[model samples]
Target: MSANTEGFKTFWEQLTPERVAHIGEYYTDDAYFRDPFNEVRGLPAIRKIFDHMFVQLHEPRFTILEVVHQGDTAFFVWDFTFRMKSYKPEVVQTIHGSSHVRFASDGRVSYHRDYWDAANELYAKLPVIGALMRWLAKKMA
Candidate 1:
Protein backbone atom coordinates (compact mmCIF):
# COMPACT_ATOMS: atom_id res chain seq x y z
CA MET A 1 0.00 0.00 0.00
CA SER A 2 1.08 3.55 -0.59
CA ALA A 3 1.92 5.85 2.28
CA ASN A 4 -1.27 7.81 1.74
CA THR A 5 -3.41 4.70 1.85
CA GLU A 6 -1.65 3.43 4.94
CA GLY A 7 -2.14 6.75 6.70
CA PHE A 8 -5.78 6.86 5.75
CA LYS A 9 -6.34 3.35 7.09
CA THR A 10 -4.63 4.16 10.36
CA PHE A 11 -6.58 7.38 10.70
CA TRP A 12 -9.94 5.71 10.32
CA GLU A 13 -9.22 2.73 12.57
CA GLN A 14 -8.11 5.08 15.36
CA LEU A 15 -10.71 7.80 14.91
CA THR A 16 -12.54 9.17 17.94
CA PRO A 17 -14.78 12.07 18.82
CA GLU A 18 -11.75 14.21 19.57
CA ARG A 19 -10.21 13.38 16.19
CA VAL A 20 -13.22 14.66 14.25
CA ALA A 21 -11.82 18.13 14.48
CA HIS A 22 -8.82 17.11 12.37
CA ILE A 23 -10.78 15.61 9.52
CA GLY A 24 -9.61 18.43 7.31
CA GLU A 25 -6.13 16.95 7.39
CA TYR A 26 -7.37 13.93 5.46
CA TYR A 27 -9.88 15.65 3.20
CA THR A 28 -9.51 18.58 0.84
CA ASP A 29 -11.16 21.84 1.70
CA ASP A 30 -13.79 21.30 -0.98
CA ALA A 31 -14.06 17.56 -0.70
CA TYR A 32 -17.32 15.80 -1.41
CA PHE A 33 -18.75 13.03 0.72
CA ARG A 34 -21.80 10.85 0.38
CA ASP A 35 -23.39 7.90 2.08
CA PRO A 36 -26.83 6.34 2.41
CA PHE A 37 -28.07 9.06 4.77
CA ASN A 38 -26.05 12.13 3.85
CA GLU A 39 -24.51 13.91 0.91
CA VAL A 40 -22.45 16.97 1.60
CA ARG A 41 -19.49 18.98 0.37
CA GLY A 42 -16.69 20.89 2.05
CA LEU A 43 -14.61 20.16 5.13
CA PRO A 44 -16.96 21.72 7.70
CA ALA A 45 -19.90 19.68 6.44
CA ILE A 46 -17.84 16.53 6.54
CA ARG A 47 -16.76 17.27 10.11
CA LYS A 48 -20.40 17.60 11.10
CA ILE A 49 -21.13 14.10 9.86
CA PHE A 50 -18.41 12.59 12.03
CA ASP A 51 -19.47 14.74 14.97
CA HIS A 52 -23.07 13.64 14.55
CA MET A 53 -22.03 9.99 14.49
CA PHE A 54 -20.33 10.35 17.84
CA VAL A 55 -23.31 12.17 19.29
CA GLN A 56 -25.90 9.65 18.12
CA LEU A 57 -24.04 6.44 18.86
CA HIS A 58 -21.85 4.99 21.55
CA GLU A 59 -18.35 3.75 20.71
CA PRO A 60 -18.81 4.11 16.97
CA ARG A 61 -15.79 2.69 15.16
CA PHE A 62 -14.64 1.38 11.79
CA THR A 63 -12.71 -1.82 11.26
CA ILE A 64 -11.11 -2.02 7.88
CA LEU A 65 -11.37 -5.49 6.36
CA GLU A 66 -9.83 -4.96 2.95
CA VAL A 67 -8.36 -2.24 0.81
CA VAL A 68 -7.61 -1.86 -2.89
CA HIS A 69 -5.61 0.92 -4.39
CA GLN A 70 -4.91 1.92 -7.97
CA GLY A 71 -3.51 5.27 -8.91
CA ASP A 72 -5.42 7.99 -7.12
CA THR A 73 -8.48 5.86 -6.34
CA ALA A 74 -8.96 3.46 -3.48
CA PHE A 75 -11.71 1.21 -2.22
CA PHE A 76 -12.12 0.01 1.35
CA VAL A 77 -14.36 -2.67 2.81
CA TRP A 78 -15.14 -1.92 6.42
CA ASP A 79 -17.43 -2.89 9.25
CA PHE A 80 -18.82 -0.08 11.36
CA THR A 81 -19.79 -1.17 14.85
CA PHE A 82 -21.62 0.87 17.46
CA ARG A 83 -24.31 0.81 20.10
CA MET A 84 -27.38 2.95 19.61
CA LYS A 85 -27.70 5.61 22.26
CA SER A 86 -31.49 5.40 22.19
CA TYR A 87 -33.67 2.23 22.25
CA LYS A 88 -31.40 -0.67 23.13
CA PRO A 89 -28.12 0.85 24.15
CA GLU A 90 -26.77 -2.50 25.28
CA VAL A 91 -27.06 -4.11 21.86
CA VAL A 92 -24.10 -3.67 19.57
CA GLN A 93 -24.98 -3.01 15.92
CA THR A 94 -22.65 -3.62 13.02
CA ILE A 95 -23.00 -2.29 9.49
CA HIS A 96 -21.00 -3.80 6.64
CA GLY A 97 -20.07 -1.33 3.96
CA SER A 98 -17.53 -0.20 1.40
CA SER A 99 -16.08 3.17 0.60
CA HIS A 100 -14.75 4.53 -2.68
CA VAL A 101 -12.34 7.42 -2.34
CA ARG A 102 -10.39 9.51 -4.76
CA PHE A 103 -7.29 11.32 -3.65
CA ALA A 104 -6.26 14.80 -4.56
CA SER A 105 -2.76 15.71 -5.67
CA ASP A 106 -1.94 16.68 -2.12
CA GLY A 107 -2.77 13.15 -0.88
CA ARG A 108 -6.05 14.19 0.71
CA VAL A 109 -9.44 12.78 -0.17
CA SER A 110 -11.19 14.75 -2.90
CA TYR A 111 -14.28 12.61 -3.10
CA HIS A 112 -15.72 9.84 -1.03
CA ARG A 113 -18.79 7.66 -1.51
CA ASP A 114 -19.97 4.87 0.74
CA TYR A 115 -22.06 1.88 -0.29
CA TRP A 116 -24.23 0.00 2.17
CA ASP A 117 -27.71 -1.50 2.44
CA ALA A 118 -29.35 0.74 5.00
CA ALA A 119 -32.63 -1.15 4.79
CA ASN A 120 -31.11 -4.47 5.72
CA GLU A 121 -28.11 -3.36 7.73
CA LEU A 122 -29.70 -0.53 9.70
CA TYR A 123 -33.51 -0.37 9.55
CA ALA A 124 -33.81 -4.12 9.84
CA LYS A 125 -32.11 -3.87 13.23
CA LEU A 126 -34.45 -1.23 14.61
CA PRO A 127 -37.49 -1.95 16.83
CA VAL A 128 -40.81 -1.61 15.03
CA ILE A 129 -39.12 -0.49 11.86
CA GLY A 130 -37.07 -3.69 11.75
CA ALA A 131 -40.14 -5.91 11.68
CA LEU A 132 -41.79 -3.81 9.01
CA MET A 133 -38.65 -3.65 6.95
CA ARG A 134 -38.12 -7.41 7.04
CA TRP A 135 -41.79 -8.05 6.21
CA LEU A 136 -41.71 -5.66 3.31
CA ALA A 137 -38.49 -7.23 2.04
CA LYS A 138 -40.05 -10.66 2.27
CA LYS A 139 -43.13 -9.52 0.43
CA MET A 140 -41.06 -7.92 -2.31
CA ALA A 141 -38.90 -10.98 -2.72
Candidate 2:
Protein backbone atom coordinates (compact mmCIF):
# COMPACT_ATOMS: atom_id res chain seq x y z
CA MET A 1 0.00 0.00 0.00
CA SER A 2 1.13 3.56 -0.67
CA ALA A 3 1.61 6.05 2.14
CA ASN A 4 -1.54 7.88 1.15
CA THR A 5 -3.41 4.59 0.95
CA GLU A 6 -2.40 3.70 4.50
CA GLY A 7 -3.44 7.13 5.64
CA PHE A 8 -6.80 6.68 3.96
CA LYS A 9 -7.36 3.39 5.72
CA THR A 10 -6.53 5.00 9.04
CA PHE A 11 -8.80 7.87 8.11
CA TRP A 12 -11.77 5.67 7.30
CA GLU A 13 -11.33 3.59 10.43
CA GLN A 14 -11.56 6.80 12.42
CA LEU A 15 -14.88 7.78 10.86
CA THR A 16 -17.15 6.26 13.47
CA PRO A 17 -20.18 8.02 14.85
CA GLU A 18 -18.45 9.25 18.00
CA ARG A 19 -15.47 10.60 16.06
CA VAL A 20 -17.83 12.61 13.90
CA ALA A 21 -18.55 15.00 16.78
CA HIS A 22 -14.88 15.89 16.94
CA ILE A 23 -14.49 16.35 13.23
CA GLY A 24 -11.94 19.11 13.72
CA GLU A 25 -9.45 16.39 14.57
CA TYR A 26 -9.73 15.02 11.04
CA TYR A 27 -10.92 17.86 8.85
CA THR A 28 -10.02 21.52 8.57
CA ASP A 29 -12.61 23.89 9.92
CA ASP A 30 -13.34 25.23 6.46
CA ALA A 31 -13.23 21.94 4.62
CA TYR A 32 -15.66 21.29 1.79
CA PHE A 33 -17.49 18.18 0.65
CA ARG A 34 -18.88 17.99 -2.84
CA ASP A 35 -20.99 15.39 -4.54
CA PRO A 36 -23.29 15.14 -7.52
CA PHE A 37 -26.25 16.23 -5.44
CA ASN A 38 -24.90 18.31 -2.55
CA GLU A 39 -22.10 20.62 -1.46
CA VAL A 40 -21.40 21.14 2.24
CA ARG A 41 -18.91 23.27 4.16
CA GLY A 42 -17.43 23.72 7.64
CA LEU A 43 -16.96 21.04 10.29
CA PRO A 44 -20.23 21.80 12.08
CA ALA A 45 -22.25 21.63 8.89
CA ILE A 46 -20.34 18.61 7.80
CA ARG A 47 -21.06 16.94 11.08
CA LYS A 48 -24.74 17.58 10.64
CA ILE A 49 -24.56 16.23 7.14
CA PHE A 50 -23.02 13.01 8.37
CA ASP A 51 -25.50 12.74 11.20
CA HIS A 52 -28.37 13.03 8.79
CA MET A 53 -26.82 10.47 6.50
CA PHE A 54 -26.41 7.95 9.27
CA VAL A 55 -30.08 8.22 10.08
CA GLN A 56 -31.17 8.18 6.46
CA LEU A 57 -29.57 4.87 5.53
CA HIS A 58 -29.60 1.59 7.33
CA GLU A 59 -26.24 -0.20 7.83
CA PRO A 60 -24.33 2.22 5.69
CA ARG A 61 -20.80 0.99 5.18
CA PHE A 62 -17.91 1.57 2.83
CA THR A 63 -15.82 -1.12 1.20
CA ILE A 64 -12.55 0.26 -0.13
CA LEU A 65 -11.55 -1.25 -3.44
CA GLU A 66 -8.52 0.87 -4.29
CA VAL A 67 -6.40 3.57 -2.67
CA VAL A 68 -3.56 5.82 -3.83
CA HIS A 69 -2.00 8.78 -2.15
CA GLN A 70 0.51 11.50 -3.00
CA GLY A 71 1.84 14.11 -0.58
CA ASP A 72 -1.04 14.73 1.84
CA THR A 73 -3.72 13.77 -0.68
CA ALA A 74 -5.20 10.30 -0.87
CA PHE A 75 -7.77 9.06 -3.33
CA PHE A 76 -9.98 6.12 -2.51
CA VAL A 77 -12.21 4.13 -4.79
CA TRP A 78 -15.02 2.58 -2.77
CA ASP A 79 -18.40 0.90 -2.94
CA PHE A 80 -21.11 1.95 -0.49
CA THR A 81 -24.10 -0.20 0.43
CA PHE A 82 -27.12 0.49 2.64
CA ARG A 83 -30.84 0.21 2.81
CA MET A 84 -33.21 3.16 2.65
CA LYS A 85 -35.32 3.32 5.80
CA SER A 86 -38.33 4.14 3.70
CA TYR A 87 -38.10 0.72 2.11
CA LYS A 88 -38.38 -0.89 5.52
CA PRO A 89 -38.13 -4.69 5.65
CA GLU A 90 -39.63 -5.10 2.23
CA VAL A 91 -36.65 -4.17 0.09
CA VAL A 92 -32.90 -3.89 0.46
CA GLN A 93 -31.34 -1.72 -2.20
CA THR A 94 -27.62 -1.30 -2.79
CA ILE A 95 -25.88 1.79 -4.09
CA HIS A 96 -22.47 1.69 -5.74
CA GLY A 97 -20.27 4.78 -5.60
CA SER A 98 -16.76 6.24 -5.51
CA SER A 99 -15.09 9.16 -3.75
CA HIS A 100 -12.09 11.51 -4.21
CA VAL A 101 -10.73 12.94 -1.00
CA ARG A 102 -7.92 15.34 -0.15
CA PHE A 103 -6.44 15.39 3.31
CA ALA A 104 -4.97 18.40 5.05
CA SER A 105 -1.77 18.59 7.10
CA ASP A 106 -3.49 17.30 10.22
CA GLY A 107 -4.72 14.25 8.32
CA ARG A 108 -8.21 15.60 8.03
CA VAL A 109 -10.04 15.78 4.76
CA SER A 110 -9.96 19.22 3.23
CA TYR A 111 -12.11 18.28 0.29
CA HIS A 112 -14.36 15.28 -0.25
CA ARG A 113 -16.00 14.63 -3.57
CA ASP A 114 -18.16 11.70 -4.58
CA TYR A 115 -19.09 10.44 -8.03
CA TRP A 116 -21.97 8.07 -8.67
CA ASP A 117 -25.06 7.51 -10.70
CA ALA A 118 -27.96 8.43 -8.45
CA ALA A 119 -30.43 7.65 -11.18
CA ASN A 120 -29.22 4.12 -11.66
CA GLU A 121 -28.43 3.33 -8.05
CA LEU A 122 -30.77 5.41 -5.93
CA TYR A 123 -33.66 6.70 -8.02
CA ALA A 124 -33.95 3.33 -9.61
CA LYS A 125 -34.78 1.90 -6.19
CA LEU A 126 -37.74 4.11 -5.63
CA PRO A 127 -41.22 2.84 -6.41
CA VAL A 128 -42.31 5.43 -8.95
CA ILE A 129 -38.94 6.68 -10.07
CA GLY A 130 -37.58 3.13 -10.15
CA ALA A 131 -39.52 2.23 -13.23
CA LEU A 132 -38.37 5.23 -15.20
CA MET A 133 -34.85 5.07 -13.81
CA ARG A 134 -34.52 1.35 -14.54
CA TRP A 135 -35.77 1.90 -18.06
CA LEU A 136 -33.26 4.67 -18.55
CA ALA A 137 -30.49 2.57 -17.05
CA LYS A 138 -31.23 -0.30 -19.39
CA LYS A 139 -31.21 2.04 -22.38
CA MET A 140 -27.93 3.66 -21.26
CA ALA A 141 -26.31 0.36 -20.44
Candidate 3:
Protein backbone atom coordinates (compact mmCIF):
# COMPACT_ATOMS: atom_id res chain seq x y z
CA MET A 1 0.00 0.00 0.00
CA SER A 2 1.23 3.44 -0.88
CA ALA A 3 1.63 5.97 1.89
CA ASN A 4 -1.14 8.18 0.54
CA THR A 5 -3.67 5.40 0.11
CA GLU A 6 -2.88 3.88 3.46
CA GLY A 7 -3.19 7.21 5.17
CA PHE A 8 -6.53 7.85 3.52
CA LYS A 9 -7.91 4.49 4.56
CA THR A 10 -6.78 4.93 8.12
CA PHE A 11 -8.05 8.49 8.41
CA TRP A 12 -11.49 7.79 7.02
CA GLU A 13 -11.95 4.52 8.86
CA GLN A 14 -11.37 6.29 12.15
CA LEU A 15 -13.24 9.47 11.35
CA THR A 16 -15.68 10.82 13.89
CA PRO A 17 -16.59 14.08 15.57
CA GLU A 18 -13.92 13.58 18.18
CA ARG A 19 -11.31 12.22 15.79
CA VAL A 20 -11.62 15.14 13.37
CA ALA A 21 -8.68 16.82 15.04
CA HIS A 22 -6.53 14.41 13.02
CA ILE A 23 -7.55 16.05 9.73
CA GLY A 24 -4.43 18.16 9.85
CA GLU A 25 -2.32 15.03 9.85
CA TYR A 26 -3.72 13.88 6.53
CA TYR A 27 -4.35 17.21 4.79
CA THR A 28 -1.89 19.93 4.06
CA ASP A 29 -2.34 23.45 5.44
CA ASP A 30 -3.51 24.74 2.07
CA ALA A 31 -5.52 21.69 1.09
CA TYR A 32 -8.59 22.15 -1.07
CA PHE A 33 -11.63 19.94 -0.67
CA ARG A 34 -14.94 19.82 -2.49
CA ASP A 35 -18.02 17.66 -2.79
CA PRO A 36 -21.59 17.91 -4.03
CA PHE A 37 -22.68 20.63 -1.61
CA ASN A 38 -19.36 22.07 -0.47
CA GLU A 39 -16.19 23.65 -1.79
CA VAL A 40 -13.74 24.85 0.79
CA ARG A 41 -10.05 25.64 1.18
CA GLY A 42 -7.90 25.19 4.25
CA LEU A 43 -8.45 23.03 7.36
CA PRO A 44 -10.66 25.32 9.43
CA ALA A 45 -13.31 25.62 6.74
CA ILE A 46 -13.09 21.95 5.95
CA ARG A 47 -13.46 21.09 9.61
CA LYS A 48 -16.68 23.07 9.78
CA ILE A 49 -18.17 21.03 7.01
CA PHE A 50 -17.46 17.85 8.96
CA ASP A 51 -18.81 19.34 12.15
CA HIS A 52 -22.00 20.22 10.33
CA MET A 53 -22.29 16.70 9.02
CA PHE A 54 -22.26 15.10 12.46
CA VAL A 55 -24.77 17.62 13.69
CA GLN A 56 -27.15 17.07 10.78
CA LEU A 57 -26.99 13.33 10.25
CA HIS A 58 -27.43 10.21 12.36
CA GLU A 59 -24.76 7.50 12.35
CA PRO A 60 -23.00 8.63 9.20
CA ARG A 61 -20.11 6.45 8.13
CA PHE A 62 -17.98 5.72 5.07
CA THR A 63 -16.70 2.34 3.92
CA ILE A 64 -14.01 2.37 1.32
CA LEU A 65 -14.53 -0.24 -1.39
CA GLU A 66 -11.57 0.27 -3.66
CA VAL A 67 -8.43 2.32 -4.07
CA VAL A 68 -6.28 2.97 -7.10
CA HIS A 69 -3.06 4.89 -6.86
CA GLN A 70 -0.69 6.29 -9.44
CA GLY A 71 2.12 8.62 -8.52
CA ASP A 72 0.81 11.48 -6.41
CA THR A 73 -2.84 10.98 -7.40
CA ALA A 74 -5.18 8.35 -6.00
CA PHE A 75 -8.80 7.50 -6.68
CA PHE A 76 -11.00 5.86 -4.09
CA VAL A 77 -14.48 4.39 -4.33
CA TRP A 78 -16.58 4.30 -1.18
CA ASP A 79 -20.02 3.77 0.23
CA PHE A 80 -21.39 6.49 2.49
CA THR A 81 -24.15 5.27 4.77
CA PHE A 82 -26.26 7.49 6.99
CA ARG A 83 -29.71 8.36 8.21
CA MET A 84 -31.31 11.76 8.65
CA LYS A 85 -31.80 12.81 12.24
CA SER A 86 -35.44 13.68 11.61
CA TYR A 87 -36.37 10.34 10.13
CA LYS A 88 -38.24 8.25 12.65
CA PRO A 89 -38.04 4.84 11.03
CA GLU A 90 -34.28 5.18 10.79
CA VAL A 91 -33.71 4.07 7.23
CA VAL A 92 -30.06 4.04 6.28
CA GLN A 93 -29.16 5.67 2.97
CA THR A 94 -26.12 4.65 1.01
CA ILE A 95 -24.37 6.75 -1.60
CA HIS A 96 -21.70 5.15 -3.72
CA GLY A 97 -19.07 7.60 -4.95
CA SER A 98 -15.45 8.11 -5.88
CA SER A 99 -12.87 10.63 -4.77
CA HIS A 100 -9.84 12.09 -6.48
CA VAL A 101 -7.01 12.89 -4.12
CA ARG A 102 -3.68 14.46 -4.84
CA PHE A 103 -1.00 14.01 -2.26
CA ALA A 104 1.47 16.72 -1.42
CA SER A 105 5.22 16.16 -1.41
CA ASP A 106 4.96 15.35 2.30
CA GLY A 107 2.20 12.76 1.67
CA ARG A 108 -0.60 14.92 3.04
CA VAL A 109 -3.59 15.43 0.79
CA SER A 110 -3.38 18.71 -1.14
CA TYR A 111 -6.47 18.42 -3.32
CA HIS A 112 -9.54 16.31 -2.74
CA ARG A 113 -12.65 16.14 -4.86
CA ASP A 114 -15.59 13.78 -4.67
CA TYR A 115 -17.55 12.58 -7.69
CA TRP A 116 -21.12 11.47 -7.21
CA ASP A 117 -24.57 11.79 -8.77
CA ALA A 118 -26.42 14.41 -6.77
CA ALA A 119 -29.70 13.96 -8.62
CA ASN A 120 -29.79 10.26 -7.94
CA GLU A 121 -27.70 9.86 -4.83
CA LEU A 122 -28.98 12.82 -2.82
CA TYR A 123 -31.66 15.08 -4.35
CA ALA A 124 -33.70 12.20 -5.66
CA LYS A 125 -33.77 10.67 -2.19
CA LEU A 126 -35.34 13.68 -0.51
CA PRO A 127 -39.01 13.50 0.39
CA VAL A 128 -40.25 16.31 -1.88
CA ILE A 129 -37.51 16.61 -4.48
CA GLY A 130 -37.43 12.83 -4.77
CA ALA A 131 -40.91 12.65 -6.28
CA LEU A 132 -40.20 15.46 -8.69
CA MET A 133 -36.88 14.00 -9.70
CA ARG A 134 -38.45 10.62 -10.33
CA TRP A 135 -41.23 12.11 -12.42
CA LEU A 136 -38.76 14.18 -14.39
CA ALA A 137 -36.58 11.17 -14.99
CA LYS A 138 -39.53 9.17 -16.24
CA LYS A 139 -40.71 12.00 -18.48
CA MET A 140 -37.26 12.46 -19.92
CA ALA A 141 -36.89 8.77 -20.50
Best by lDDT: 1
Q: What's the distance in Å from true for residue 47, model 3?
A: 0.6
User: For residues 1-141, what per-residue lDDT tens digits would candidate 3 score against the true structure?
Assistant: 697789788788668998787789889998999999999999998888998989989888989999999999999999999898875438899899999999999999999999999999988878899999999999999
Residue 112: error of model 1 in Å? 0.6
Candidate 1: pairs in clash: none
Question: Per-residue CA lDDT of candidate 1, range 64-102, in tens?
Answer: 999999999999999999999996999999999999999
Which 10 successive residues of model 3 have the least lDDT summed?
82-91
Task: Count residue pairs with overlapping backbones in model 3.
Answer: 0
Kindly provide the TM-score of model 3 when superposed on the true structure, using C-alpha atoms: 0.95
lDDT of each structure?
A: 0.94, 0.74, 0.90
lDDT of 2 by residue, 76-96 (tens): 777776677767545666666
In order of appearance, the predictions have TM-scores of: 0.98, 0.82, 0.95
Using TM-score as the measure, the top candidate is 1
Give candidate 1's whole-model lDDT. 0.94
